[model samples]
Target: MINYKSTLIPALLIIVAIACNRPKAAPAKGNAVWDSVLQNVQTAPVKEEDASECIKLNGQIQANEDHQAKVYALASGKIKSVNVALGDKVQKNQTLAVLQSMEIAASSNDLVLAESNVAMTKKNLETTKDLYEGNLATSRDYTSAQVDYNKALSELNRAKQVQAITGGRNAVYELKAPLSGYVIERNISGNSQVRQDNSNPLFTVADLSNVWVIANVYESDISRIHNGDAVSVTTLANPNTPLDGKIDKIYNVLDPATRTMKVRISMPNPNNTLMPDMFVTVKVNAQPASSMLTIPSQAIVLDNSKNFVVVKDAKGLHKKEITVIKRVDPKAYIQGLSAGEQVVTNSQVFIYQALSE
Candidate 1:
């Protein structure tokens, strides 16, 4: 009786295990895997973008056209008077002032003496010609008189030119504007001493119709900039408004110290509001495109080892390295990234922390 009970209990234990272990309906392997995949797709979390696609680049603002003219006297002299003041508008051929020059006075006196000599020689030549025709004077005497008269005539003409340049006696040296514009600089006072040897400009006149915006571009990004490309500029003085302009020049030489290249933009200032050497922010636009593969500019994580992006994968957040091709206005054209895939934008640090654990 004890042996039968033990054997029956063992058989009952095996039967119970088989019944519990067997699948209820023997599901198909293909369908099971498909179902599991479907579940994953439904439960997978969407990544929130931590940053926007916008790329903010630094730049500067300035004028399109600007020039400075150094005012100097052709003949050295003491300043007799100054007619214009600083920031005064002068016209072309407008006399700025007069000057009293000893050199001019001497030239004028010499011119007067030359004129008198020429007149006297002309009268003497006339008398000699009459005497030679009447057989009262020799041909050699007439020739000598003729030579003197010719020399006197030449000297008189040269003297007249000198006197004219001196503006009569005390060279009324007039500093005139070459072009009609404002006097932006004044290096001389009412009686400031000016010299030809000195390099300092006595006065400077500038036409502030247009100005140039000079921008410093990084060494790596200089290729995008080309001559005649479009550009925009801004200033801290006028933050909201961006002044429109174009790419006028791209400097070939790179600055080794700053590791930057120079880019120039020309902008108009009809009201003469813009000045030369004003601080500004500049934006240089390369080309227009219909569409491009773009990503958030700030989404790119740069670490010591590599540059990468966090992707929302099936298991969890994954960081993958990427290559950036072009950085346009709002987005970055890049490779090693797929479209329509959710990426983490906001709270990247927190997500990365969770992923690290």
Candidate 2:
């Protein structure tokens, strides 16, 4: 009560000063200055036309089965020498390793013995035939000689066939590549015992010139994918590189655990840059649907709570709230916007900042 009059007058004066001196909010978004700047910004009308949609999924690069080979041991043996390691490129029929097998040695000895018998029997058959014609030997004797000679010849042929199939000489056998490719895996090392019936292969070779992209389509997205659909594949390992391919196969089986179906895409790897098990991104372009309102993706400005775009008209610029339906790269399908409307496509941050104030 003692100072009420003095404080009240000063408070009233302060309020009047603030009211007079406080700056006014800047003129609405598109003044003459903004119009000049807007000249530099590109604008495009929202188009109502069928637009292709794309489905994105995570996938892995795999070697094409048709171009891949799994090399197994032809016979039980000890690995003598491994000529190729993982990632080594090899040519067709190139020896990948050598195996030391006692069984092969026995086969080699038998082949040598069979050759010698064939040579000896040929001479004996010639002599026996001549003796029979000259009356120097009985018919029974000639017949017995001919039958034994034929039997020995058959045995020699069998031994040769075995040697040819096994690719063995002395006590060693060679494991050769069936196709030209890079070795992606090596299961057996030098001096390792390998069995003929091993469930796994000793080496895996792939002609990486062509590869497969395996993508999992969730149960919900399976309907959008089909065989022969065009797709693009990319990898984080090499972001600049993108591979084009098509859906070559769709597996009938669904993975019960993952609730997804496998989709196979064959992609050409001209530089052999793609490798098996490399994580990759797959995008399949789905067919365009009926026309809808769409705008360039950059035109929309996102804020704390909503997305907005600056629409220009004879009246000037105004902020318009929009509902984005589906966004593809560089384009956005949206609602609350109409076709033939002019929306700011670039420098949105500058326009938005000026107007927000």
Candidate 3:
């Protein structure tokens, strides 16, 4: 009670110190000279540079369907032996499995008959030609022999073609890969009964050297995308690895369910790391804009359908309408802004509000 006056003086000084240390808010209405510095408003000059616009899309990694093959038994048979397992790498024309069937045996017999007929008819043609030259055979008889020889030759040619597809040695058929690739599927095993009419195939061999990136282009983005656009694909499993590719195909029709058109990009997968059905992000690089002027996105103010920016000049701040050509985050490519011009990057909304009033 004796130091009440001293206590009152110290409390008042503390109150005044707290008030001076607090941060000040930007004024509602003020000129650059009056309050811009006090509000800490900043400006940056417009710059010109070559910049690329990219559209990011979600897609999936798939085996290049064109470079893949489905192995089907040439004829109905029971699988005798499966020589390869799933994920096994195989070379072109490598035998993958062996099958045993009466159908295969019948094909072998037909090939043998065709061969025998060719040999027998060839001998007859030689004899008949000699007889005709010696005046011992009629012209019609020689012609008949020639026709038989031609028929036998045609049959033999057809048989050889069939035999290549339906390979059989002692009623066992060998299923061979058509291309060098890893085995993606194994539908048949030892002693499994495979049918020629079955919908499913025995194995799927796919060349993993290059893969397909299938992306869906929405209706809004379809007009901007074109074939041969550069694309970068990254997988979530290994985000550090990015694969480069190009758009090779854009389907003409739209998907009924998704209402998006499918686009295909070919990506090189030399390491065999990109697997089918892996989710990935595809960044399609659009044509670069040359010497476009850009400013910080925060400087531009959107009003209704029109956009404006606050320009600080010798006179003061003034609002100028601008047309945004493209926008990358934090920057906008605009038509009205000139290079070397100063525009407010922050606290522009305060200027916009005062100008609107």
Top-lDDT candidate index: 2
Error of 3 at 314 (Å): 17
Summarize candidate 2's per-residue lDDT along 1-357 as a digit string, tens digits.
234344433433343344356543334454444445544556789888676778998999899999989998877899899999899999999999999998789889999999999888889889999999999999998998888889899999998999999889899999999899999988989888988889998999999999999999989988888888888888989877777888989998999999999999988788888889999999898877777789989899998879899887666656788999889888899889888999987666556555563
Q: Which regions in candidate 1 have their CA more than 4 angstroms from the true location?
A: 1-68, 163-171, 212-223, 249-267, 287-291, 295-357
Better of 2 and 3 by TM-score: 2
The candidate that wins on TM-score is 2
Residues 281-344 of candidate 3 have per-residue lDDT tens digits of 9888888867788898888888888999888776656678999998875778888878898898
Which runs in model 3 stand beyond 4 Å of their true positions?
Answer: 1-51, 117-154, 289-357
lDDT of 1 by residue, 23-69 (tens): 33212344433233222321112222322222124654432334546
* Candidate 2 Cα errors over 4 Å, as ranges: 1-44, 134-140, 301-307, 345-357
Q: For model 2, what is the error of residue 189's alpha carbon versus the real structure, in angstroms, after optimal superposition?
A: 1.3
Comparing candidate 1 with candidate 3, which one achieves the higher lDDT?
3
- In angstroms, how far off is 277's CA in candidate 2? 1.5
Worst 10 residues of 1 by lDDT: 37-46
Q: How close is candidate 1 to the true structure, as a TM-score?
A: 0.61
Please list the Cα RMSD from the true structure of every candidate, rounded to 1 decimal place. 15.3, 9.0, 8.9
- Measured against the true structure, the TM-scores of the candidates, in listed sequence, are 0.61, 0.82, 0.66
